[model samples]
Structure formats: structure tokens, C-alpha cells
Target chain A: MKILIVGGGKVIYFLCRTFVSKGYIVTVINRDHDECVRLSRRLKVTVVHGDGSDPQILEEAGAFTANAILAITPNDEDNLVICQLADLQFHIPRTLALVNDPDNEEVFRQLGIKTALSTTYILSSLIEQRASFDEITNLIPVGEGKVNVMELLLNENSPVVGQTLRDIAMPENSLVAVILRDDETIVPRGATVLQSADRLIVMTLPENYSQVLKKLTGESE
Target chain B: MSSDLRYFVIIVGCGRLGSYIANKLSHSGHSVVVIDSRESAFNALSSEYSGFRLEGDATEFDVLKQAKTDQADVLIATTHEDNVNVMVAQVAKKLFHVPRVMARVFDLKREKVYHHLGIETVSPTLIAGDVFLESITTSPIAKREGIGL
Candidate 1:
């Protein structure tokens, strides 16, 4: 994908790296000359030194031809304007914006902008995870609750240890998506056996949350 | 305009500044709508804002339609990404014909270009710098803008 990113901060830097690693054509626009120099020298991406919110600058950076535009600047207004330009003017197929304030998400939505509110999402995830540790570490709803993404931690005394996924009676709506052991991640299969100290990422229904948690952690209480 | 009349405002990208604007606008009797792709971002909003909430990608045309962007009088894009904000604003102005479009700009060099394109830009870093400079000055000329510390 041809991607245009407007920002030179850590977020843009990391995103550029990820996109490049995935073999996407990435171009970054920023006002900071030093940052632009650093990215150009270090990363396999294009760097443009200009204001990303400006039409002239964006044009200079080839915003009109980009397949996807990511507005990850520090200011919410800039991100919104960029999305507008990409969608309304250039008719870019995909435009993603980073929302700094979770409250204003509705405003962006109403204006036909796709936003990712990181602060609000991260804080909510942390709070929810802390509040419902025993049930599930992370319960992220996907596709309007048709599927849920959950993170489950396994303990040494869990009853499901040493048993394969097929041996355990998994919830009807639940399926293990990924497993984190030490630092590596593994895709769980029916033949995959449960082990102690494993962190499982599962997809299930809201109603099956408790059941899935119980089956994975071996703690009914 | 009657003080009792409610104004509808759409703010894209619910980040720090976006949330601040939403709180201020809603408190001032404006009906606010927020849209973000990240479902978890809605927690920052207080229950006082009873406006519609949609969790989806802002870049997708369907998501914008779901947010009712066509009916909004003013659209504010405060996302960190400049490209996204510009794209959203451009669409609102050219296609949807939103009366007012305000964008937050982090890059100072693009300010002139944004103005030329008929989009309002706000930079926190420049504003903060002006505020800092105004505080140290003895003449108090900077106080005229009310940007003092």
C-alpha cells in the first residue's frame, strides 16, 4: 500500500518502520528537519519536510496519490483536516486519524473521519484489565460484539495444563487466537497443548467470557 | 441565536485536545458527536455527552456516513496525524460543505499552506511558546492576546 504519514514523532517513526517492514510504500511529512533527516537516514521510507496540514505541503509529499493516509500528529485538528483532504479532495480510499481526546471521537465520526483514540483506548483497557483481572486481562470487542478479543494468563496450578485444546471442553463461542509464552507468540490449534505460564489471546462472545476464562485459567471461582 | 438553542458539533479524533474541545462545547450547550476507530477511546467521555457514538475507521466513507457527517454544522479534526486531519477537513469542506473546519497543525511550516487551502490551523507548540515568551517579557505586550501563563 502507498501510505502517507503526517508526523515525525515516535508514533510516526514506529509506524513508518512497521509499514516498511511489511513492504508498504511509506512517505512521511514533518516540520522538524532533524527528525526528517534521522528518518531518511535510518528508515527505508520517503521523508518530506513541510507542514502536513497544508495543501501545498501535502501535494509536495504526494498526498493525492496515496492509497492510505495516516494522520498521527500531536494535534487533533491537523489529523482531522488531513483526513478531510484525503477523503473529500483526493478521494483516498483509506484515511486513519489518531484521536487525542476520546470524548471528541463522535465529532470525528460525524464528520466522516476514521479515528484511533489511543489515550482513551489504552486507559480504558488498563482500567478494565485491572478491574477484571480474574475474568480476563483484556476484553476487546471486535465487529460490534460478534467477536471478542481477550487476553488470558495461565498460572502454574491451572487444571488445563498438560492438556491439549481438543482435550479441554472449550466454550462454544470461544477460540484461542494467540499464545504468548516468555516473549514469543504462537497460534493455538486443536492439537496445541496448554502449558503453565502461557498467556492466551482468545476470541469469544461477550456471554461466553466467564466460561472461556474458566476453561483457560482452570479457576471457576 | 437563542442561548437555549443547541448547536451540533462533530469532533474527529478523540485525543487530549479533542476531548478538551468536546467538554467545552458540550458544556456550552452544543450537541456533540464523537467518532473513533478505537472502541476503547470512548471511556474518556463523561456520561453527560449523550450524543451518538460510532466505533469504526474514520477514513472509511461508511464510517463517516455512520457518524452523520453530512448534517454537522462544524467539523473539528484534532487527531495527531496531519494527513488524516487534512483529508477529513478537505472532504468536509468540498464534499459535505461543512460551514467551519478547524484542524490542529503540529508542523509550523504548513500553516501558510493550510490557510491558503481555506482550513484553519492551530498549533499547541507555537501557542505554548508564545505563552512562555509573554510571561517573561516586561512590557506586557504579549498579554494583549491573553496567552499569559
Candidate 2:
């Protein structure tokens, strides 16, 4: 895909590199002349040194021909305008804008921008997950509710202590993904019995979350 | 706009930032409702607030109706997913015509794009920077304008 990224910051740099590595045609537009010169040299992609929101600059950067335009500039207004120009004016098939303010996400979506990334929302989600669990150490969403992989620390009160995988009444759609104990990870089988300090990595559906929590920690929900 | 002497606010996402905003608004005596796709997110909230909680995708029309977005004075989206947040906010503002809409943003640079699209955004990074600056400096009136705090 021919992707036009409207930014020259570190985010754009990484994005451009990723697209280039994937063998996609990448072009970046930025106001900083030096950054453009450096990026154009570092990555074998087209770089335009001009204001991204300006129609003339966008035209020069071939905004109309690109498969998608990503407005990732640090300034929200610029990203919005660039997306508007790409989506509304140029009729680009895909337009994505980075939303710096979680609050303005609605405005961009209302304007018909298909994709928006808010860092605050991402960081806060991570922080909230960390705050919610005591024994469940790391909870990462593998794919929606189909698979949620979580790292669990087994304290003395855990019900799985001294119980082999075969004896425990594990819920449906739940499986032991991995086990980390004493700074080492092991793939568990039916013969594997959990120790008191064993850190188990488990995957389960969203519906069986509380049950899994209860089973692993022996805590009443 | 009603003379019923009650202000209604609807917050979409029900995540940490969303819950924080809802709690703050509710504490200030405003009628607030919070909605999220996941029910687990709303478990920590107190039940004393006169607001409803609905579990569904915020971008869906049916979900918004269930949450009574039409009657809200303001709709805020703080969902970590930017696409969902923006979609919910737009639906609330343009479709439901909520009087006010606010979105939380993580990337400090997306401010220009959001502004151009006619959305109000609150950036925690910028707010924290301003607060940090304010602590060492004397600017009482400047502090008052930092988003009703």
C-alpha cells in the first residue's frame, strides 16, 4: 500500500520504517526541513518538507494518489485538517488520525475519520489493569474475548496449590498458556501440578473471567 | 436547556479516565451516566450516583439509546481505543446532538486534527505539564482556566 504519513516526529519515523520493512511505498510530510532531509536519507521513502495541512503542500506530496493518509502530527488541528483534505477533498480510500486528546476522538469520528489512536487511553488501560489485580499479574488481550492471556501469582491461599492440572476443575475455554516460576517459564501439561509460588499464565474467555479469578486465587467473588 | 434544575452528563468508555471524570462530575452534583463495552470496568463504581450503567459497544446506536445519550447535556468519551472513542463521541454530538462533547487524547500531537474536526479535547500530558509548571510559579487565575478544575 502506498501510505502517506503527515508527521516527522519519532512516531512517524517508526511508522515509516515499519511500512518500508513491509515493502510498502511510504511517504512522509513534515514542516521541519532538517527532519525531512534526515528521514528521506535514513529511510528510502519520499519526504516532503512543508506544512501538512496546507493544500499546496499536500498536493505536492501526492496526497491524492496514496492508498491511505495517516495524520500523526503532534498538533491535533493539523492532523484533523490533513485528514479532512485527504478524506473529504481528495477522497482517499482510508484516512487515519492520531488523537492526542481522548475528548476530541468523537469530533474526528463525527468528521468521518475511520481510525484514531489515543495514547492516554492506551496507557490508562494498562495502568487500570495493573491496579485491578493482586495475584493476576499481567493481563494482555490476545484477541477480544476469544483469548485473554494473564499472568497469575499463586500465593499461599491459592486453590490450585498442590493440585495437578488434571485434578482442577478448569472452566471451559480456559487453558494454561504458560507457567513462570523462579524466573523460568514452562509449558504445562496434565501432569504439571502447581506449587505455592508458581506463576501461571492462563488464557480464558471474558465470560469466565470471575470464575478463573476465583479458581486461581480461591477468593470469593 | 430544560428548567428542571438538573444537569445530565453521559460518559462513554467507563475506563479509568472515564470513571474518574464521571465520579468528579457526579460528586459535583451533576446527573451522570457511564457506559462501556465491558461490564467489568464499571464494577468498581459506587451505586449511590443517580446514573445508569450499560454494557455494550459505544459505537452502536442501540447501545447509545440504552444509555440515554439523547438527554445528556454533555457526552464524554475516554475509551482507550481511539477509534471507538471518536465514533461514540461523534454519534453523541452529531446524531444525538448532545450540547457538549469532550474526548481524552494520549498523543500530544493530535490536538490540531481534533480541533479542526470541531471536537473539544482534554490532554492529560499537557494538563500535567501545566500543573507542574504552576507548582513552582504563582499564577492563581491561570489555574482556574485549566478545564473547570
Candidate 3:
């Protein structure tokens, strides 16, 4: 997939490296002339040096053919303009913006920028997750925060450890997608039995997430 | 115009142009609220300007909400930064559904973007360029040559 990233520091560099290693076509638009030169020399991605919010710069960065565009500028206004331009002018399918102020996330969403990720929100959520829920190895909001993907670790003391998938009373609208035990990935079925040390990848709606977690890991709300 | 017909306006950025517009609007009996990040910017407003002065960044939605932008009949974004003005204008127009939205953009290329987004723009650069071009084309060179033609 072709991806375009605008205006970031070390985070952008690491992201570009990772995407390049994965063989995805990556393009970066940066305002810093020296950084652009360094990125071009160090990575396989194309780097364009100019104001990312500018339509001319976006066009030069191949935004028209990009499948996804990430506006990671420090300025929230710049990020908003970049995402809006990508969506309205280039018709990019996915437009993501980095909202510096947590409150602007909703405003960005209202303006039709598909995804607005607030760095502060994400960092605070991570801290909350670590402090509150340990069994939840991973949690991610998908489909515009309508659905959640959770990873729960099952241990010997878990209530559903030895139960079969069909026998366990899973919450409504929740599905155990996969189980990873001893490095074996299993697509869960009705006959599949849960075992100790099994890592479950579950998907559920936001309303049913806590119930699903309680059922899988015996964690109470 | 009657008092009932007066518009409730929100002006972002207390720069020279913004202050001037706010002063004029307030003088005409329009309810105006001017927002600026710096408190000292309000000093630019004249004594005739009897509008509310909000000291906060206009890009933040909370500040806009505090200024009651949702109830504004007209919103003007006159920040020095074009992107800030564009963002504020878009939010005011698209999110709040303000009846009249305008911004001051300096770049000629960004004017097209403002047009596409259905926001009105006043560009000093473009206006000055047009005036200069007109002055050169309409110059009276024969008078300087003593021809009096």
C-alpha cells in the first residue's frame, strides 16, 4: 500500500523505516530541509521538503495515489488542513491526523477527516490500561471506536480456562477470533477447548467489551 | 438597520485587520467577540470597539465554544497564519454551520482551497498585486513627456 506521512520527528523516521522494511511504498513530506536530505539518504522512501499543509506540496508528494495519509504536524491547524486537502482534493481513501490538543479530535472528526488520533489521549489511555488491566495485553479501537479488539491471557485460575468454546457463555456480539498457545495460532471453533496460557484475540462492540473481558479472564467491572 | 437585524459575529486573531474589522462591526451595533492568543493583542482595539475580548487560541474547539461560536451569525478568521485561518474557517463553516464564514489567506494557491471549501477569503497579496498591475497599465506617461495628451 502507498502511504504518505507529513511532518514528524523521530516517530516519523521510525515509522518510515518500518514501512519501508515491510516493502510498502512510503512517501514523507517534511519542512526541514536537512531532515529531508537525511531521510532520503537513509531510507528507501521518497521525501519531499515543503509545507505539508500546502496543496502544491501534497501533490508533489504523490498524495493523489496514496492509499493512506497521516498528518503528524506539530500544529493542529496544519494537520487539519493537510488531512482535509488529502480527503477533498486528492480523494485519499484514509486520512489520519495527529491532534495535538485532545479536544480537537472531535472537531477533526466532525470536519470529516476519517481518523483523528490524539497523542495525549493515546498516551494517557496506555497509562490507564497498564495501571488498571493487566490481563488485557492489548486493546485497540477499530471501526471508528464502534468495535474493540482485545487480547486476554488465560491462566490456570481463569474461570473459562478448561471450558469449550460452545459451552462458555460468551457475551453477545463478542467473538473469540484466535487463540495462541505455545506459539500455535488456532482459529477458534465451537469444538476448540480453552487451555491454560492460551492467548485469546477477541473482538466485541464497545458496550460488550467489559462483559467479554469478564467472561474470558474473570475480571470484574 | 434595526437592532434585531444586527449580526452576532466572532472574529479570530486580534491582528491589525482583525481589530479594525471588529471595531467597525462593533461601531455598527453588531455583537462582536474577538479572540486572540495573546492578551496584549486586545490593546489594538479602539475605545469605540465595545465587543468582548477572549484571550485564547482560536484553533482550540473549547475556546471557540467558550466564545459561543455556535450562535454566531458570522465568523471571520484573520490570523497571520493561513493554515490556522483555513482550519478555523472550515470548522466554523462545517461544524458550527455558521451562515457566513470568511478568512484572510496570503497565499494565492490557498485561495483556490478556500473557494473549494466554500469559504470567502480576503488576500492582501492578491489585492495589492491587482492594484499595482492596474496602476502600471493605467499610467499617464504622455503628461510626463510634456505632451499634455
Candidate 4:
């Protein structure tokens, strides 16, 4: 895969070495001239020295033919703009952005950037994951995870105990498939009200798992 | 705030443009609150300015909420970096639902994305470039007729 990376930081440096060793075509762009010289020498890859957010700079970096653009700049807006330009202007297939502030991730996604990840959010979610463990359990992955089915056990503390399936704001591309209550399996309908001790069989797109988990358990992450 | 009352303006970044706007608006009797990551940037504000000064990264939700961006009638993001300005402006406009949000974008090329995203952007580069272009185009007319900047 051809990869274009934007940033002068350690993350970009490490990724450059890793991707190159794996035999992927790698290119980098950094605003710092000194860092560009160092990266060009260390990685034996093309390094363009300019503001990554600028579309002209992206064009100069050969963004058009890149399979993916990973914008890991420390500045969230620059990362967002680079990804956006790569996606919208160049029609690059995949775009990833490093979010400095986690709150901007949703907005970035809403603005049509494919993947936005943040070290701040990941590390914080790691902590949150430990605190909110067992809220959702993976049952099994069917068909190489195009469909993910999970079992969500509802307790009295669950946010959906009294609410019907229709009333609950489930994440997009997710639904309650079945409700295992005692000896009977109840196929969930919109009017089906959640009861405590109900084992919900949910089928969701894999990416929406975390949101579904958090909402089902009433755990604020 | 009530529409009949003076506007509550929140200006992020106390850099040259931010300080100027803060000073002008505060003098005009609007409630002005300026935020910058560096406290020293606040020094640029004129002594006549009597607005609130906060030192924090305005792009952060908590920092902006602390500055009461939700209550802002007008939120102007004038950070030196276009990236900062765009992020802060979006947070103010989209997240906090501020009535009017403006961003100072240094790169003129970024105006399209800003416009598409529905955030009002003032590009200093375009403003200055227009003046330079106008001078080049109109200098001959001005020299003959006598009045042009």
C-alpha cells in the first residue's frame, strides 16, 4: 500500500520505519526543514517540507496516487484539513487523522473524514474501559466481522430497563436482535420493553460497539 | 443574553488581531472575554481594555465552556495559527451553539472548507493580497487621479 504521512513527531517517525520495513511505499511531509532532512536521511523515503494542511503542499507531496494519508500532526485542525483535502480534493481512498483534542473526533467524522483517532482519547478510554468493564461482552464474530453479535445483560442500573427498543437511541447500524428472558427467546420489536436480567442479543456494525456498550450500561466514557 | 442588551463577545487568542478586536469591542461597551494559551499574549491588549482575560487553549471544550462560550453572542477565533482558529471556531459554533462565530484564517485556500462547514472565516492573507493586487492594478489610475491606498 502507498502511504503518505504528515507530521514531524515521534509517532510519524516510528510509523515511517515500520511501514517501510513492511515493504509499503512510504512518503512523509513535515513543516520543519531540520526534521525533513533527518527523516529523508533516516527512512530513505520522500519527505516534503511544507505545511501539511495546504492543498498545494499535498499536491506537491504526490497525494493523488497515495492509497492512504495518515495525518498525525499535533494540531487537530491541520490534521483534519489534510485528511479532508486528501479525501475531497485528491479522492484518496482512506484518510486517518490524529486528534489532539478528543472532542473533535466526532466533528471530524461528521465532516466526512474516515478515521480520526487520538492518543489522548485512546489512553483515556483505556482507563474508562477498565472502569466500565463487563458492560458488554462479545458473543462471536460472524462472517469475518461484517456482522458482530454481542450479549448485553441488563440490570436495574441499565439505562434501558424501562424503555422500549424504539425509544432507546441505539448507535447507527445496530439493533437488538433477540431478548433471552427465561425459557423463551423473544425477537425484539420496536415496542419490546427492556426488563432487568434480560440478555440482549445485539447485532451491530463493529465500529459502533463501544458506543452501544456505553449506552447500554449507562457508563459515561 | 437578551437581544436588546449589548453583545457578549468571546475572543480567543490575544494576538495582534484578537487584541485589536477585543479592545475595539470592549470600548464599544460589549462584554468582551479573551482567551489565549499564553498569559503573555494578554499583554497586547490596550490598557483601556476592561475585558476578562483567560489563559487556556480555547480549542478545548472545558476551557471554552469555562469562558462561557455558550453565552457568547459573538465568538471570534483569531489565533495566529489557522488550525487553532478553525478548531476553536467550530467548537464555538457547532458544539456550544454560539449564535455567531468567526475565525481568522491565515491561509486563503482554506476558505472553501470553512465556508462549506458553515463557519464564517476572515482570511488575513486574502485581505492583504487583495490590497496588494488592487494597488498593482489601480496604482496608475491613482497616480493620475490622486487618491488610493
* Candidate that would win on lDDT: 3
Fnat of each prediction?
Answer: 0.20, 0.06, 0.80, 0.31
| TM-score between candidate 2 and the true structure | 0.47
Model 2, B23-116: lDDT tens per residue? 7777667888888878899975766555677888775566778888888888888887554555566567787899989887765454554666
After superposition of all CA atoms, the RMSD between model 4 and the true structure is: 10.3
* lDDT score at residue A31, model 3, on the 0-100 scale: 92
Model 1 over residues A4-107: C-alpha lDDT tens digits? 99876787878888999999999999989999999999899989998776777878878778999988877676777777767766778898888676644555
DockQ class, candidate 3: medium
Please give the DockQ score of every candidate, comma-separated.
0.11, 0.05, 0.69, 0.28
Best of the two (1, 2) by DockQ: 1
Winner on TM-score between 1 and 2 is 1
Question: B5-116 in candidate 4: lDDT tens per residue?
Answer: 7999999888888899999888878899999999999999998999899998876767998998889999998888888788778777777799999988877776666777
Worst 10-residue lDDT window for candidate 4 chain B reads B138-147
Model 1 chain A, poorest ten-residue lDDT window? A126-135
Q: What is the lDDT of candidate 1?
A: 0.76
Return the clash pairs for model 4, or none.
none
Q: Using DockQ as the measure, what is the rank order of every candidate, best first?
A: 3, 4, 1, 2
lDDT, residue A110, candidate 1: 65
Model 1 lDDT, residue B77, Cα: 87
